[model samples]
Target: MTTVIFVHGTGIRQREYNDTFEIIEQKIHAQRPDIKVAPCLWGALGAKFNENRASVPLEDGTLALSQGEEDADIVLWGQLYRDPLYELRLLSLKPIKSRNPFGEKPGDILQSRVASLTPTLELEANLQEAGIAEIFAQARDTVIRSQPYKGALLTVSESDLSEYYAAIARAIAAQAMFISELQEKFPPILTDAQLRDKVVELLTLALTEAKLGLGGWLLKPVLGLAQHGGTNYIRRNRVELTDKISPMPGDILLYQTRGEKIRQFIQEQIAQAEPPVVLLAHSLGGIACVDLLVQQQLSGVELLVTVGSQAPFLYEINALYSLEYGQLLPEHFPEWLNIYDLRDFLSYVGNKIFPERVQDVLVDSRQPFPRSHGAYWTNAKTWEAIISRLP
Candidate 1:
């Protein structure tokens, strides 16, 4: 039996992941009665997936899951919160090298210092209370204003709040590494000063990498509703477009950079599965699935389908030759059809996708949508089209 793996996206909560998987499964099963489907939960929150001594100690001391929990294979899919790791790296005792010679606002400087350490719920609340939120708003405004004055712009610029969150993630991973090193070299009962030194060292490493200096490469530009003007911009407009089928857990941002971690977990899962699997990913999850397929590592995936997906992950592959370099090429889709809705902001339009090598179907989504992001399976026509295309 083929296993369908569901990888979730950012701002997704545990219960929402479960419910979406259930809805998708029921629809898929009704069409292809024999398939076995499952949802994989990865670390959407920073602390939840800490590979540190603290988590182990806490689990051993207080609460722990019972045995036999491994009945089904576990895969950490979607985005992982990496802000904690970045934060750890930023918090090293060594004074962080300031790229901005003018120096950041006092609150910005202080919040960055604290955010680079562990994420305590109270610490976050305190940062907001202490005017860091205002500092960030001012920073955002400064960046916008400095658009014309290129030279005066801060050398270490983080374009989005997501980047700051990512910094927090870097801290967590760095902390875990620091603990691992401590365990390896030092004996039990380390002095407070020793711990302080370690924290400084880690933070230094994180700050160095996070520096957005001239000629530094940019990863994926944070894609979402734009801040203003465009129909796709969701941030500036406080419009709630969620479509609900039931009373399920709402979405949440667990930690920064959770996307990358989730993607890695899914890649590992696909690689290790005993039986061939089918990856059905929606929106950003679809991008993660395409990433796995293009790696040429998953020999077991019979088919891969992306619905209402962002194009870059699949379009850049070498398999689909019809696409042009830097011009949005469509290539090497894994033995299945890719579906898009016209009004869905996640999916793109235009360019000739090879009908023979890789199938592409576009659906009109201007009609009432169930949700702003995930209406692919909920719509009857979309489900029918998907069922027809399955192998």
Candidate 2:
């Protein structure tokens, strides 16, 4: 069968990710029925990879690849092991073939000799040859930097992984129930800082419980993104900045059940699909797509529509981070809508009406109910505006 593998990326729960994909599928199938659509969930907190590998290395030298599914062609994408395997395969190649080559041709001997010698040295070398060792080593660290996080790392006793998997299952199940509720509610009005805090908390909790041992490495960037997102959300909403700013948005919005992770999963699904996949990410999700496109991590996101989004602000926020580190913004942002609610604090924020910043459409949503930062996507007006953008 011809297959479209939807690879969900980082930070999202699976069920909500699939819901967004289902929304896109509905739009596409209405026009064309021959295509098959599927969401290949990569699970959260790198869980899918971990689960695939099964036995992770513990404080003890022993490790196992946990679940017993030994099929080599697991995902069928071929992207998973191709590059690494190809590099390894190159190591086994023989550059020079010698039968009685003690005194063969000099020219062939000189060039072939060096090529043969190179692989010999390369094979015996450390994992730096593959270049993934550092990341793996960091993943193996035993101690965490903070004491408060000790309980988190330790929570993932061997028996706890099954529970962690179950918890993720529960998180995704709860999100599935909550999604439709989101469609009807007004967007919440938490500042970017507030949103970031929530994301950080959820991520910390998730990582801690899972025993990923990646807290220190993941914390700053995660917090930074959340805060940056929160700040950008406020600036985009045009909430009047106090002389002394109040709380920043937390990392996780808590309402939509981790929008960034869901957004990443959707785009990843799009990237893995056959041509003609439609994608609709509300608010920060659109921001995520723009970032994905900019990073060249995904492509071919046909019929992309973002409801109540803040794509431009992401550029600015990324620019702010890049400036702080003396780096350059990589590429131009993509084309998408910036749906806004006039009454919503996030809607009044910076460059809200400007079209030059990647097809900005200042959508005015008349929220039928009281809402905050997370409610903007659920507003009926927002959906109506988005329907116009869908193919």
Candidate 3:
């Protein structure tokens, strides 16, 4: 009946993200296994640079890092999740290099077959059961007539022709799956991407039988067009720079400019959760949770638990995105629970500023400043405070 969304703060990379999440999850479930703990891992979307902070300079007015040759799928999926037509649009940007002046233009082959694609397999039952049997046909056409689809076909060749149809199948299926996946009754064996890829494989085989290369696998054609990109560096650095010195502060800097992606991800988690959801946010994650809930009311959210968060600080300085200095917490804002430690400079009390709207609880980890900031997870008193307040 209740879900706790563990919203982690800045600098917690992927590996640490998993480990830290497990720590809290196991601890919570140990006491109350009935409660579900969801992970809100938004660090990767935070600020990062492949050029290695090229924008930041030292005491002297010189660049910090040198240039690199090349570096990214989470990046693609991030865009894809937001816009189902994203990959189709990206494919359209590619110049068509096909010069096949042979029998049956590859474009025609694509349009003809693409319109009628259906799953002959058992998955068909799930589609029919979900009352979405026409999902494939609709998805296929949606991809075909799209501006990107037309553009991709304009100068295309036999080799890459299959790729376009497959992409259409993928885009359409992605949207359908995105909606259907939320239905607990119709569980999918394959993920949305996986299902699309499987269907694309079948289509690829059929197209190949028709005496066209279709570029072998759809993955190659999709990835071949894109070289190294900046987001790829975000992943690369997370892997390569695993040391403590690595800065994840870019999250704070980037969130101001590109906060929607992070907020949307949180919202998606909220959507998946049952009602009476509690957001257990830390640091910048707390800021994001505040910003999102402030702008619009999320149905299930009941309380926001901010551990050493800067949401109040940001609001005090008039820097909080959703609420300015003179503004008050929205009338519909969810209940707030702010946790702070005097030892941790990053932690701030919300009671003084927001009054009854938020309650600030102090639990000292005895560790000084920066160490105290991260010690909240390890301290018993912190968990005691958190557990006592959970709905």
Predicted model with the maximum lDDT: 3
Give a tens-digit lDDT track for model 2, residues 76-107. 11211222122112212313333444544433
Per-residue CA lDDT of model 1 for 147-257, tens digit only, reads 221221222343332334333332332333344344563322123333423333343334344432112111211211111222232222222322221112222232222
Model 1 alpha-carbon drift over 4 Å, by segment: 43-260, 272-274, 313-333, 349-356, 365-372
In angstroms, what RMSD does candidate 1 have relative to the true structure? 20.1
How many clashes in each structure? 42, 48, 0
Order of models, best lDDT first: 3, 1, 2
Using TM-score, rank the candidates from best to worst.
Answer: 3, 1, 2
Once fitted onto the true fold, the runs of candidate 2 whose alpha carbons sit more than 4 angstroms away are: 1-43, 46-267, 297-299, 314-333, 347-355, 362-365, 368-384
User: Residue 50 in candidate 2 has what lDDT?
Assistant: 27
Q: Cα lDDT of all candidates, in order?
A: 0.46, 0.37, 0.71
In candidate 3, the residue pairs with backbone N, CA or C atoms under 3 Å apart (3 or more residues apart, or in different chains) clash, namely none
Model 1 / residue 125 / CA error / Å: 48
Estimate candidate 3's alpha-carbon lDDT, on a 0 to 1 scale.
0.71
Using lDDT as the yardstick, the better of models 2 and 3 is 3
> Quick one: RMSD of model 3?
19.8
